[model samples]
Target: MPNLLRKSFNVVNRVRHTASVAGLSALRVAKGERPDAVMLRETFEQLGTTYIKIGQFIASTPSLFPRDYVIAFQGCLDQTTPLPYSYIEQVLKEELLTEGQSLEDLFSKIDKEPLASASIAQVHAATLPDGREVVLKVQKPDVEVIMQTDLGVLHGVTKLMEKLMPQMRFASISPIIDEIRIRMMAETDFIAEASNIRDFQQFLQMTGNTKVVAPEVVEELTTKRVLTMSRLHGISMVDEVAMRQYCDDPAQVMADTLNTWFASLMFCNSFHADLHAGNLMLLKDGRIGFIDFGIVGKLAPESWQACMGMMQALQDNDYVTMASCMVDMGMTHERDKVDQAQLAGDLAKMITRIMAEDKTYTSGKPFNSKEQADELNKMMLEIVEVGKRHGIHFPRDFALLTKQMLYFDRFMRTLAPDMDMFSDARVSLLGSDFKQ
Candidate 1:
């Protein structure tokens, strides 16, 4: 009976929360602001944590969303207000304490303040009983329950919208929400994230990679809601000034980072999906640190080969191979309808434009990051459109691969402007292929 009452209360609260945000959205629409991608993204941000995560999913999965919506949601921030330490402390005790154990028995010291706070969890600095520096990732109170209730509401609303608005039927909103729910639930499970970290650690050991590292999971203190990991000390890769104090060459760090990541695509159990500035650091020992294993991606063997071939072809300007590889990597209900010759010609034009832009980067003019990002996004959208014309549709993994490559490209431009990623002798794009 209590469980039933609690669930009913949760559903009512979720409806109230969503209605408040929807009212603001309706007001915006009434103000002559056409409901577009930008407005949709703004509405999602105001809807709170679940919608922010959904917005990020839309941004990263270009294969599933329109070009404009994908581009607009790229700026969706995952930050949220931090919960009070007392609340966090209650959760820690509920999850961590045993019959005979106490708070002091497990930790030497734990800071009351958070090191980093996100929508799902917040990280706090602490030391183990043995004096090992670690960070505790604590899931917010009732996060899982809230996510479940909100997703149920989102799914029902999507179905109703599709029925009322015929044009919305083609968007497949329900399935997208289902996928988001699965990913969000996984994000809340610290055990799964810990497994991802361990898999990465094993991959590093097998590859004999000493230049990169991930945080070690402290298994004893880890649970579904709480993950304890050995703390990593480093300077941000983008903080060139602080980085110079630890390492003389910032470009070398970028090279190591790129090489390790590329190799992981072929060798690791799963490659890190989200490698933003916050997740990457240049450690005091001059090695790259990859933190936060909450998100990862896997590619089938055939897809991996085709993706590598496509990247290699881009460097060589072999449009035929690039076109062929695209067909191999993509999905289509009617493969027989594709015209390879036309696809090749269209790909050649796009590659030629990119090559021309590459020359500008080396022409001694100042590199405008915003302009480069805008141009790249345009080209990516164009590529998708071109593929669609030929009855080929890239999968979500392809979008994930391309997005990470975009991040690497931006980093390389800032750190090693003269180097070409694919053509550079130092970068090992094919992990085992280049092994000695």
Candidate 2:
């Protein structure tokens, strides 16, 4: 009976949310706005959580969505207004309370004001009874219910649209809806995120790497909805001036980051997938701190071996080997359809043209200019296009990998202007002997 009541409440809440979204969109239309991708993205951001995840999905998935929509949803904000403290306290009480223990029994201090707020969770700076500084990551009230309900609503809508409108079939809306459900559900599971952090920490320890770290999860204080982690003090990696206070050379930080990340591709259970500026930091202790393990990517062993091969090939300017490794990394419905030689020739031409047009690489300078960045993006996209032409479709993990590599490229341009990413002696591609 309780479960049924909860389900009913969730449906009612979803209905109200749908009505609100419709009303807001209608008002915008009445103001003489056409229903374009930008407007839709705005609507998604305003809707929060599930919709924002969908928008991000669109942004990350160039192979699945159109160019204009993908471009518009780039860097879609995950931020939202902070929920009230009363609600947060209530969740803590419910999730952490025991037979005789109270809030005071657990924490010495939990700040009412949030340090940061996002669509799904709010972070508060806190102190343990033993005087340890930590952060409380509390999920918004009913966020799980809301996300599940919204996904159901979106799934149904997508199915209906696909049946009624043939033109919508190309977007593969239903599959996207399914993928969003999996990702959003995982995000809501703080326990899983905590486990990811632990796994990464283990990876670091095993590799004898002390230059990089992730926040330590306070297991006793953590739950599926709320995560408690040791607080880290640092400056964002991109802020080179602020970083100089702790580290002499910020470029070394980037090198440590690159090496650690590349090693994780073959050695760790999963690699950090969403490592944007916000998630990476140069700690006051002169270490690179990787935080927010909410999203991770696990490549198959065979796929990773191929990825290593591809990287080595790139360094050697061996486009033929790179093309073959790409075939191994990506999936295809029709294996016989792929023409390896043709794909190799296309890749060779693409890289040559890009290098010639950009001149950044040959000029021995940082790829800082917008034109250089665009050329890099074009090269990645053209690689994908070439793969598609040969009937190969890169997996979601490949997209995540590519996106992080691009982010690292930006970081390199800022911190290590003269460094060559492909041949940098400090960066490790896990070497030829690395095996999972």
Candidate 3:
């Protein structure tokens, strides 16, 4: 059989298996048996690369999936079985070889054991001839074929869902799939990741943020399928205990991280989209290091400008301006648009209640109190419900931005109980004060 036909057959078989497993799990749940999220995660893992990636994406995109599924799939960490050393050698020979230098010439010693393996790529620590330690990231062989086939299956499934439920405005699953496909393709190219690193490095240099670090890409030793970058030493930011050992001011580190990300959003044109604990680390040199630049988000100039306006309006307590800016950002559809005047009135009422509860609060800290947090969350939920009733569907980007801010909110509560995110001097956007 042709390679494409064989892959398609495999994909169809995998999809059938997935459906069977999900159905069985549903039946078990219906029978009052507690279904294991880990089992479901493992099922996706067994289905191969694309499903694993989708599982991880589902874990991150809380706004899109149900809470139970998201919580369960969070256990679906990147853990893939390693490829054979022979296959690794073949890839190196085919993809990394230049005019004369061979795999043996490139590395003085190559580790057969992979350091880590994910759905798309695996990392191995290798030593250069000159004694420099580096991490070699190799793209899985035939991954592109597998991803294309799986994505096709995903498209078909999503299309079926849309047809079955016309009222379910699930943000056009096709565009989301297309976006994921673009990102996956870019990720398969190490050269693109190298360029991303260079771009971020240049941004750091210009900004004079000495506390931030990005790994230097070794261009001479890097290729399309394999990337060799300077090996950074440190624990992930999620390791709070380990991080505290390196820096006395873990809160400052968190602050610096938020500041750096905010700066990137305003100035760099491109910002790291996937910044879960794994992608952020505390380096030995007391600086923040960011890795895995394969996925990024770009905001058009107008969108960003409108975002600035929205933030400014929030600060100034001008709900009308905030609503207008949101409209400009296309958060609310025309047909489903709530009465702008009524939205402004309701928002003002909520703001007044909040202000009455805490007169001196300008930061996110005061809301961290359980009662206050509940009230705020309730208010926001009401707002979203009202928007939904009005037929206003929020874009995915807006949802993602809000989710990231919520992450920051949680981080701030843990790290700096008193820090006011809204009024922090370090949280400047676009090199200017937010509209207020």
lDDT of each structure?
0.83, 0.83, 0.72
Regions more than 4 Å wrong, model 1: 1-4, 164-168, 315-317, 348-370, 433-436
lDDT of 2 by residue, 1-436 (tens): 9988987887797879777997999898999999899999988887878889889877776666666787799869888888899999999998998999899999999999998898889999999999999999999877888888888888888889988998999767788788778877999999999999999999888888888989999999899989999999998888788889999988888888888888888789999988888899888889889999998988776786787788778657898899889888756656567898998898889788878776676887555665677666666666666677677876767767776887787888778876766677876666322334
- Separately for all candidates shown, the number of backbone clashes (residues 3 or more apart, or on different chains) is 0, 0, 0
Q: Candidate 3: misplaced stretches above 4 Å?
A: 1-48, 55-76, 81-87, 98-101, 160-171, 239-241, 244-248, 301-321, 332-338, 345-365, 368-385, 391-396, 430-436
Give candidate 2 misplaced runs (Cα > 4 Å).
1-7, 23-34, 165-171, 308-319, 345-366, 431-436
Backbone clashes in model 3, listed as residue pairs: none
Global local distance difference test of model 2: 0.83
Residue-wise lDDT of candidate 3 within 1-436, one digit each (tens)? 6976887776677667667866876787799876666667777776767777778666655445555676677667676788887877888787778788788798898889997787788888888889988888888877777787778877888888888887544567777777667766777788988988888888788788788899889898788888889888888776567888789887789878887777777667577777766778888878888888877776654666677786678768898997777667666558344677777776677677766766345455555554554354444544554445445556555544554665566666666766776666765555442211
The residue pairs found clashing in candidate 1 are none
Return whichever of 1 and 3 wins on TM-score: 1
Each candidate's root-mean-square deviation in Å? Answer: 2.7, 2.9, 5.0
Backbone clashes counted, model 2: 0
Q: What local lDDT score does residue 33 receive in model 1, on the 0 to 100 scale? A: 87
Residues 183-284, model 1: lDDT tens digits: 889899999999999999988888889989999998988999999999999977887778888888887788888888887887788888889888999988
Q: Would you estimate the TM-scores of all the predictions?
A: 0.92, 0.90, 0.77
